[model samples]
Target: MKNKDPKANFGIELDESIQIDGVSATATKFGESFRGIFRWQQSFFKLVWKQAIIYYIIYVSITLFYSFALDSGNQANFDAITSYLARYTSSLPVVLLLGFFTSTALNRWFSIMASMPGTNRPIALYVASLKEDAADGCARVDLYIRYVLLMWLLTFRIVCKPLRKRYPSLMSIQAAGFLRDHERLLLEKHKEQPGGSSKTFPLVVYDWLNILLRDTCQKGYFSVANDFGRNIDAIQVLKKGGGNVIKFASKNVPVALIQAVTLAIYCYGVVSVLSHQIEKHYLTSVLSGYFPLPYALPFFFYYAWLKVGRIAIDPFGSDEDDIDILNIFDCHINGAMRLRNCYGVKITIPSTDRSAFSLS
Candidate 1:
């Protein structure tokens, strides 16, 4: 048998990004925690290895510069500066800031993911309202589902760089079957309006979706339209979630806090190596200045921790650590398209009594 794409199990197509799912699905034993430690995709090592290498290179260059380049007089001044930095670095609260920021980012990221609007609710609403839909209802269902998904893409395109890659322009999305040609002409007209459109054209898609939905609903084609309030609720959730993502990523993370933490980590590393220069003084400790092991630990920890926060804030980005937005889109496309394919109700059960049936 041919090997299947792992994501197909989730009813999604190949996302062409990273896949971290199913790595530990069967690792139920206590010792199995390490099952995915070495996997290149979505590994912590994968996320931070490039930065780690650059850090070590810079640290080593600074170390060599200190040990060999400086004259005795300049070396003494350098030592003084490093000592001063090392002394005050203790007050920076690097750990506290990192811990708080990372925890908060992680919590918000989870919320964004949970609140990501999926078509499941809309699909359920369709099923509830029109189990035996008319032909016109089916056409409306097709249009409604497409519009819902288009709205998601429109909003996500505001924040998600990857989705923009898939649908670079609203015209591209339209050509790909997401919008009607008339809708395309309407968007174009909107784009040419007073003051010219925003550099980002997709922002108008929200307004378009709003107008499209209102007009479509006005015809009263839906048999039982009350359930559609549920779809509206889902759209509200999507917009709110998108707004949170934008606000948290761009505005929530305090710039000063980040700068302080970054300076602390880098400054600590450079000063730490110089301060512990055992070769210059009488050395006793096995791990001294030349042995970067001491500084390496904290540097790696803080740097990697900060990167986790960076990836957490923009979960829709191109990074391997980003959440799979395409999966949700696929669920909408493949599953929601079957909204009008419902069959007659099947309520039959076995006629045999439970007591009469043999356990064997």
Candidate 2:
């Protein structure tokens, strides 16, 4: 439904209705960039394997130490060892939970920072610069926590059958269609407004659409349902928000919390299973060899599955994804420069050939 008052800029208020095909150009651009970052099969696999190896090493060292403590029969040592292992197990999920949160938050922060007119630097440069800012220590810590939470959620969801079942193609198309329609309406309204600069209108519309697309299609309740066909009741709430912005803000926090709890539970179960397996095989000939292999298996498999799933679901980050970030940035920059020129503001391009180049 479109709002009657054209002046309501506090929230998304469509002034006209227009049906458009596919995603808006701005969305397509961002999507492409996202895919490029995440979609490279070799890079994705490397990251997965690297994480798996690190986890495997840690698991092996801890399991060996516990096994030795058990063999020694020192009550104090055994109790201390068990307690440490338990703590480690309990913390695994928390680490994962934190990774996911941190990643999403960092991504959001960078996205916002990158969008600012004055900060026209590349994405990687922005991230590097942020990392170097000692004054932003608190912000960095917050981002780190969010990243850990994001990783945990991503790992847990990849392993859970119910979560995997939620993803689907039809929903993505439908969501894309809805976004395109509203974006077109907003663009037409901008065009119709009196005294609206023709050049300014397109850039504003592009920025508006960029923000709206992130809200609707990026992640959260609506994206989950739209991307996966999950029969979640949250879709109703999202629709009620009038636009996706409210829905994104309201749903993301709860979702993050639930994911953190779920990861904690999953980690507890894994630890319990591992502990039992170790106890059963302790002081036996099989203990020397059998324990280490099985101990490493679960963590290795879990991490591998996580990396693969991220590759699949977020293929937009890959080279094969439909969107291209370089082109989108180029387009936006060009549009902004054009608008500046229209306003008689002098600006210079370093080089036409280099201007549209991809970071990769």
Q: What is every candidate's alpha-carbon RMSD to the true fold?
A: 5.3, 22.1
Using TM-score as the measure, the top candidate is 1
The residue-level lDDT of candidate 2 at 194 comes to 82
Give each model a TM-score.
Answer: 0.74, 0.29
State the displacement of the C-alpha of residue 93, model 1, in Å, after optimal TM-score superposition.
2.6
lDDT of 2: 0.37
Cα error, candidate 2, residue 173 (Å): 30
Instruction: Compose the digit string of candidate 2's lDDT tens values, residues 1-360.
Output: 121223322221111112122424254454654544454444545555665465556556655666565465654565565557666764465446545645664454334223222111211121222223234433432332222222222222222233223322223312422124554455457768886533333244334323433443333423133432221122222222212221232233345554564466457545644453344443753463344555545555554444443333332233332122223323333332322223223359676676688876
* Predicted candidate 2, C-alpha RMSD: 22.1
